[model samples]
Target chain A: MNLEILGYSFIQKGLIAGTAIAIICSLMGMFLVLRRYSLFGDALSHMAFGGISLGLFTGIYPLWTAFIVSVLGALGITKLRKSTKISGDAAIAVLLVSGLGIGVLLISATGGFKVDLFSFLFGSILLISTEDMLLILGISSGIIATLVALRKQLLHLTFDEEQAQVSGINTDKLNYVFVVLASITVITSMRLVGILLISALIVLPNITAIMFGKGFKKTIALSVSMSVISVVSGIILSYYLDLAPSGTIVMISVAMLVGTLLFKYVNVLGKSHVIQKLTSEA
Target chain B: MNVLEVSDVSIKYNGHLAVDKINFNVKEGDLLGIVGPNGAGKTTLFKAIIGLQNHSGKIKLFGYDEADYQPLLPLIGYVSQKVSFEPNFPATVSEVVSMGLIPEKKLRKGAVLLKNCGYSWNLLYKKVGKDSDKVLECLKTAGLESLKDRRIGDLSGGELQRVFIAKALVKDPVLLILDEPVTGVDADAQNKFYTVLRKINTENKITIVWSSHDLEAISKLANRVACMNRKLFFHGEKEEFFSNKELLKTYAESAMQMHMHDHN
Candidate 1:
């Protein structure tokens, strides 16, 4: 491994921004996965594509438009699920298809900004400007602060929403707040892992950590560690291999999940073997 | 003295009235059982009293009006019917119980939550922590001290119920509300659950308002019973509720309707 590869300015930027996005997305993902909204992340990211296209067509900053559209999309999904007969997954499906269609139409309408569209669709982490790094840091800190301040209330609502409401939690307001935060989280993370693989960052680490049966705090800690390892290592490896950074990161996350499952299986088999040996000796 | 005063409370869901003009008063330390068929508004009445749903009319707890009930929520613990969570929620018995103390500590004591949840205070000297002794006491009272570190999902239905009871008791609530807590529990587990609730009510002197469809259990355990089918049918002593043939018939009819709906 060439240690000097880390000396590149783009590499440094990618590492810093990617690390920040990884931490927040992993934390946010734990709740999303637990609440069974794993696919919502994917849906929102796709919707963010449409937002990006709209931004391009209107000659505005794409990320800012994405931030708005994704938040609105998240809130819309929540409201639709609650108000109509549409289930959560169904709502996500509707949004996912519509988002892609709109993205395609806007891209064509804008005379095909292929280079810009490609950069957004698949993340161009190497092209992350200093301002993007600052934005990522600011958003990550805000998300972290909000989660810390409302940790207990969020836990109550996550574990038992009805009981939380009964305990005087403003559940309706909290739901909106949470979804908006999550939407912002999804949008910010797209720069590091791209629209396609953003949900992987949001889901894979937490699900892997859950397989270990640790308590909530421990699970969260483990997930964050896993996410950091995946992001940092994937960034380094992709630099060395000259591959797509987002794909590399998502693949590493998937690998980590599979590794945990295999380890659990092995552990179970080893325990059963030990039990059998003890019985024979007796 | 009445601990819970609910008067002329009505709830409508999607423009259909679920609980209509319901009025019931539960005295301190009374074990009041609410029995009704599905969609009979027993749950709605409970929801209204606990401030989970919007309703017309008034509810007073400890003589305080509805608007002021938020501060007193820690004093009122509720367990909803068929409460389900993520199978791998990653909460231990102690951790889940600690959540009950958050509202209390946040509202009254303004103490750092790490202590209230039973983390060692030595790690953070300046942070005022929850009293570990009080948490253990609540766990002991609910017979869940032995399972404090065990994951809640690993426990049996009866054990989980006890953990929830301990969770509620951690706040030192004067009132405990349970909705069909034993509905899916095994027969032996159900009996044990009732025995635990009886202890909590009679020995600890905590007023309990539980909703169930178990007529026999209500007759055996509750001092007072309320029957309902959207509107309040009867609310009185257990003997009167059971002995009144007309009320019993109404309850039976509601149960029959529920069974028919299930079949359909």
Candidate 2:
């Protein structure tokens, strides 16, 4: 392992971008998983891809376009779900397929077929520019600040919407804000993790954290820790094995989830013994 | 003066009229029990009052229009039939109870309300306390003090129901609305639950409006009763409401036929 390579400019940028995406995605993922909106995150990521493709065809900044499109997609899905009997999963399925279809159509129509969409499908940490890095930092910090300020309201909405509303927490407005925040997270993470695989970063770390987390705040903290560990480890492994950084990062997250599940199983088994002993004594 | 007044309120769901032209007045400190069979629009009425559903006509709570009560929501506490909480939702009992205070206090000040609910400020400040004093107080009120530290998912159906009621009670609302609060619970638990509810009404002077299908429970517990089947059939003193021949006929017909078939 060349210790100096870790300090190189490109590697440093990749690490910062990777860490920022991990933090934001994982934090948002905690709420998403709790609310059973994991598929919404997946659908929004695909929508961002469609936006990116459109931006590519028009020769504009894909990030801005992707952010706007994903937010619109989130709003559209929410409205559709509310006004119709369509299940959330069904709605996401529709959005995902249509978004992918549009992306493919636009890419081919613009004669950008040879533009290597595979890079966006997987990811290329080496391609992250300083501008993209700054966007990631700004988004990550904004998300953290908003969450901290609205922690009480967010926690209320997440746990019980009706009760939260009865207690004067504007659940509808908060839900809209939550969806928009999720859109930002998906768009910000698209550079490091790619639109196709962005939700993996958003969901897997949070799911892993939940197994060991004692409460909502702790779950968020653990999720950020897990995300950072996975991204850094994945990037390091990718450097050594010559693999895609995003794939390696997702693989690391899956490993962490599996590890946490095993640890939880052992803990539960140990507690059952004590419970049995107490029951017998009683 | 009436604490709550609903006049000719109707609710339509996708072109179907769930509740139609219902009128009622709930006096201050009234323990109003709403009883009707399934699909009788009892829950819809509750939802309409809370602004969870759109309805025509008018509703007033504490002399203010329902529309104006958005800011006064903290004065009203509601427990719905749907208990839909995340099974592994991360929060201690005390933290969950403290959520009831979000309307009354800012994040930091809400911690003080949490302590007032019976949790120790010191223990709450720590990672997780062993069911704070405030949490235990709520549990004791709901008759689940022993299960304070247990996760909401780990509770039995009856205990979970009580926990929801406890959550509502911690807010100390002037008006408490419960939609089928005792459904799916054992007879003993139901009895105990009603006793707790009666004590809260009589001792603490909290106003309550609960919906239930148990006529006997309603008769025994309610000072006032409202009967509804898409429209208000009766809304007055429980004795007068139950004694009305037409109202009794509506409720008794099904039960009477079931009894006749059983005897045959």
Winning model by lDDT:
1
Candidate 1 stretches greater than 4 Å from native: A274-282, B10-17, B56-58, B64-74, B104-133, B239-257, B260-264
Highest-DockQ candidate: 1
Native A-B contact fraction in model 2: 0.64
Predicted candidate 1 versus true structure: per-residue lDDT over A1-282, tens digit per residue: 867978989899999999999999999999889888898889999889999998999989998888887887778878888888798789989878878888889989999867888888788888999999999999999999999998888888899988777666788899999999888998999888788888999999999998888788889999999999999999999988999989999999999999999999999999999999999999
Candidate lDDT scores, in order, read 0.84, 0.78
Error of 1 at A179 (Å): 1.8
Error of 1 at A191 (Å): 1.6
Model 1 lDDT at residue A58: 93
Runs with alpha carbons beyond 4 Å of true place in candidate 2? A1-4, A114-116, A265-282, B105-140, B144-146, B241-249, B254-264
Candidate 1 chain A minimal-lDDT segment of 10 residues = A161-170
Binned by DockQ into CAPRI classes (incorrect, acceptable, medium, high), candidate 1 is: medium
lDDT for position B80 in model 1: 74
lDDT of 2 by residue, A1-282 (tens): 766768788889999989988888888888888888887778988888888888888888776777778898888877787779789689889878877787888888878654446666677777888987887798899998998888878888888888887777777788889999989888778777777788888889888877764766677888899899999888888888898888899999999999889888999999999999999999
